[model samples]
Target: MLQKTIHKSVACSGIGLHSGKKVRLVLRPAGENTGILFALQNGSGRRFLTPRPESVIATGLATTLGQGGDSLATVEHLMAAVRGLGIDNILVDVEGGEIPIMDGSAASFVYLLRMAGERTLSARRKVYRVTKPVEFKREGKLIRAEPCDGFHVDYTIEFPHPLIGRQSLAMQVTPQSFTAMLAKARTFGFLREVEYLRKNGLALGGSLDNAVVLDDYGVVNTEGLRFSDEFVRHKILDFVGDMAVLDAPLWGSFTVFASGHALNNAFLRHLWVNADEYLEEVSLGLEPVAGLEAEPGMVTASAAVLA
Candidate 1:
């Protein structure tokens, strides 16, 4: 399958979650083989980092990319949007340390990408399809990727809070599935944990306007949830976003248990470290590089993960 990119450039502005600084994000089309690259568009000096699975550094509150002395925080939502739309090449220009937290969901990003429209490129698409099972285990949380007929996931999350005790969701990751089922889920935080999160230099810019805040037993947001199981759906959104680090589409059935940003990154790292486990399918699971939806063609991969 061929690659895809935005036909035009689009921009959005918001505040950083930890830095509390206003930031602007511009998305522009990129050439084939250029992959997904992020440029820091500020006086901090322009440094670019490809959002690779191995490049993920911190996973505390969000998926953060750190290289040398620079970093990008809270990138999962933006990435999930990019990945779900099946776009392989795009340039993200962020003026601050973090991507804008627009509506705490990937829907806004989808709207922006749609506004720019999408065009097929000249390069064949690539996909990382699991051929063997490779697993990563941490504390009791474990994530495993196994060979499957197609890309799918079975994720289960458990929290001490009564509202979100245990939630599980399993689905095949598809463009239609993502937009109809996963796009509207909003990121949620606990109201009681807000102070501690703030104390730790996290969620400083979080507000009712951007995220869903849950109190002791119920939601505090004036607007209720966009989905009945918005929490689990949000987790799925995050998984899709984090998988974008591969800089391509992924195909496999993964079983995730109590995994968050850190574990998600680790899981991708495991697959990246074992090159033989995945094969690139440009035709079956990817869009053709020539603006055609073609069957995924399989190719063996090597050691690298992302930019």
Candidate 2:
């Protein structure tokens, strides 16, 4: 399996979830081994940032990656879109401190990536494969990961609400499955919570248009739910994004229960700190699977899975 990057540049503008200001995002093709590079525009100039477990400085309403005094908020959805589509190298240019909410799902980012197209590179892909089982638990939340041939997730989310009770989903994450199943699931929050966030000067751009807002009894969105299990699917989408903080893609079967952004980042930190006991970096060979020719839109699970 070879590394991949975008074929051309693509740009979009939208309102930031926390900043409530117009933000511009540009995606440009990068050379092999570039990974995901962020060129953050600021008053001084552009500063490059590479996502890492420790770089996550905050996880209130969204994952915030920070270095020095610079930080970018609401990055998970876009990260999920990049990793889910099997893009190995790319340059993300951000003009605002936060990524656009974009309907609070990865769907828009997926569309942008597809429009940018995909190009295979000469370098073979590399991944950090789990070599031993590891479990991280905090309070009642938990994340357990075990060795697997590909990236897989069994996630369960429990909420004390009539509309959300408990939802669970398990799947082998691939471009086909991620695009068809997880990409459209929108982030959700409660009515009271939204009010509190706004009062405290947060989630300023959040609304029914970007997120699935639930009142005391049911959904407030006129469109209703995108899927019966959209909540759980969204959690899985977030899990993919959180794991992308690693320098290389991770390959493992993860079982997550009631884990949020804070717990997810904690678990990732644990795994990274104890990497000698849990991870093995392996290079996926250059050749495509026998009898399978690499082509655009090909669903080849034989290639190592993306986060």
Candidate 3:
């Protein structure tokens, strides 16, 4: 498949999940081989960062990518949207330290990407294909991955709550499947936990509007669940996002059990450290690499400024 980027720029603004402060995000097309780049607007000036397994600095309530002294939190949803849509290169411009937790799901990001449109690039796409089966286990959580033609995930989440006992979802992750099956599933938390987080200065922007809050007996939101198995679906969505931290798309069949952000990042780090033994980098179409830069400019002037 050919590499892809957005056709034009798109922007959105919302409240940060942890800071509870307004933030703005801008998406712009990028040149082939740029991968996913972040332009962090901080006190000094703009700084660039590319997502990598080791770049993940935090995974408490969400995944946070950091470099130097700048960091961006709650990036999984947006990253999931980018990878799910098969986009190979793009620029993410952030005015705040955290990505906006839009509805606590990837739906808004999907919509924004669609609005920006998609443009195919001249360069072929590269992906990491798993060559050997590997498993990473921590405590009771586990993540297993093996070779696959495309990205696939079988995820199971277990909770004692009556509304969420044991839920499992398995699917081939494609644009259609991700948008219809996983994009709208919102993050969830218990009522007591939410209160505790707020008291400790966390989850400040969280509310019933963004998350599916639950009490001892049942769900606290009046609107109820988006799907009967929404919890598991959201977990799968998170898994997709976490995997996007790799330099390129990873083609594998993943079986995950009770794996959260911490476990997910740990497994990814293992894969990165043992890449030669477990991964094969394959480029599609075998196109010539010479003289490609002579083509028309792929990124716009505004995007170049951000980059």
Give me the runs in candidate 3 sitting further than 4 Å from their true place. 286-307
lDDT of 2 by residue, 111-167 (tens): 999999999999878788888899898899989999876788999999999888999
lDDT of the candidates, in the order given: 0.79, 0.90, 0.89
Q: What does candidate 3's lDDT look like per residue over 189-307, in tens digits?
A: 99999999999999899999889999998999999999999999999999999999987888889999999999999999999999988888887654332222212333211000011
What candidate 1 gets wrong by more than 4 Å, as runs, is: 277-307
Cα error, candidate 3, residue 233 (Å): 0.5
- Taking all chains together, each candidate's TM-score versus the true structure is 0.88, 0.94, 0.92
For residue 48, model 3's alpha carbon misses the true position, in angstroms, by 0.7
> Positional deviation of 207 in candidate 3, in angstroms?
0.8
lDDT-based ranking: 2, 3, 1
The better-scoring model by lDDT among 1 and 3 is 3
What local lDDT does model 3 show for residue 90? Answer: 95
Q: Candidate 1 on 46-105: residue-level lDDT in tens? A: 888887777888998789997777888999998888888778889999888898887888
Q: Model 2: runs farther than 4 Å from truth?
A: 286-307
CA shift of 112, model 1, Å: 0.5
Quick one: best TM-score, which candidate?
Answer: 2
Candidate 2 lDDT score relative to the true structure? 0.90
